[model samples]
Target chain A: MVLWIGGRAQGKLALAMQKWPEAKILDVSETDAKGKEELLRSLEDALKDERLVWNHFHLFVRRALLLGMEPSEIWEKVASFVDERPDLVVICDEIGNGIVPMEPEERRYREETGRMLCKLAAKADCVERIFCGIPVRIK
Target chain B: MMILIVGGSGCGKSAYAEKRIMELSLDGAMRYYLATMQVYGEEGRRKVQRHVELRKNKGMLTIEQTRDVSEALPKMQEGSKVVLLEDLGNLVANEMFGEDGAMTPWEIVADKIVMQLRQMNSSLDHLVIVSNNVFEDGIDYEEGTRDYLRALGMVNAELAGDATQVVEVVAGIPLMVKGKE
Candidate 1:
């Protein structure tokens, strides 16, 4: 799987679309997945094809935090899916760079998202960071 | 040449920018560190102190200019100079809201910064700017916060266009987003 990570509005989804024009693009940001399990199930079905684009995967992390789901548990499920299907393309925004949120839930969300991104980057065959519409291969 | 180094907080963008400046500086080339942050309280003071400690003995002359970055150009010597502007986030805030709590239009603030950056680029031997990545939080902030972020995003895009090299530092590793090296 290929992981594309970068700051918000850095053209990550646009680049992903350009790369996989024929793939099914699923934007989790617009999805109605209320919990981790539902999100994972939807992602598993989406990854059935040879090329599938999962945009804004960090939104899933946010939902998981809201549901009080453990990041490790979510990562385990995601790792299994990626292992099962190697042609997935994941796009996520790097959201942990700003000032620490004052709210406890926001803090937890940031921490969980950071940890999950690290794991995704580690497992993905390719990792690229987009900045100002420029894609830099990180791994 | 202009180099833009951007990243999240504590991602080592400052350290990387400083090292890049040092490498670009030659003998007798004046090294200036343009500090754009105004230390407000304990947290701000500690952050500034930590940055000072990080650059200790680096032969840098720190120029504390919270806003009006272009004004510092006259103070710099007329030789080969390498300047590392620590950040654009605080600079944008300072420009948007002044000392007396007056608000400048966001477009003007972005324009002013971009103009200053362009001016600095033409004058200096090497210009390395450090900026924070601020737009990834999923929450919809208030109108004021949203305006600030929009202005910052505009400024960063302009800087990236003018920069000869753009690097995003992650976990102390410099990833080149544009240009070679």
Candidate 2:
């Protein structure tokens, strides 16, 4: 039930849960516009089942994982439901998309996110990474 | 009770079992080894032969079987203190997939193998089951491959659920996690 989100070549990190048989699918990676509806359906299905969980943390690079004061407060709002709900999907992104920024805010953001992912991955049953769009498991 | 040793390749389950037998005997405890690895290849056969010779030199009772591990259940001496089931991984492969070849129809065969292994849990005294944690494969799996992987996890969980001790053997060191050995 843990998810590791990191840069490319992290695919190996995301393999532990998939290796267990009781783990059922709430949803898998489906980012194409055409697959959005299915993704939503799967998310709903995932909400219904206890076994469905996810590990692809950084593929959705556009969306930043909600963290910090306002974001953390927002997540706190949903924390109870996630705990109460059976099925869930965890999404991760590589904020370290390139060089570590010299700017204060950017670097802090990167460090915070990366640290969060390492903590999550440690709890996650699996972790994975992508490079040249090819997924390699890292956990 | 039978002891089961479960772990991945190079995890030292066999060596640990031997050490356990040798050490336990020094305290006046009687034990036996029930191994599932067979001498099937020139290289593998020789490796097994070396193990056999070593056990003989140490004057240990080692039972080596390539198939039908259940057959070894009844041969233990009465009032014996430990029964070491050296592995479940290879036994599953050899019993379900045949030692020398594939099972023509794998489904029915896998079922039979699971059945036999589950039965072994009940038929032994102090079993220490060994298996490799195979979950680190990151790629998605084909349906059949996934099914087998699932079964492997289930079997491990069940054994861990009932075992008196669960140890993770890493770099030849046994980290006790669940119970007394």
* RMSD, candidate 2, Å: 10.6
lDDT of 2 by residue, A5-104 (tens): 4332223233435454576543245534234344334444556555655545332211233222333432342344355552444546565544556767
Q: Return the TM-scores of chain A for each candidate in numbered order.
A: 0.91, 0.45
Candidate 2 chain B minimal-lDDT segment of 10 residues: B132-141
Candidate 1's residue-wise lDDT over B29-145, tens digit each? 888999998889999888877767666567787788999999989887777888999789999999998778778888899899999889878998889999988777656577777
Task: Report, for every candidate in turn, its global Cα lDDT versus the true structure.
Answer: 0.82, 0.52
Q: What DockQ results do all the predictions give, each relative to the true complex?
A: 0.24, 0.07
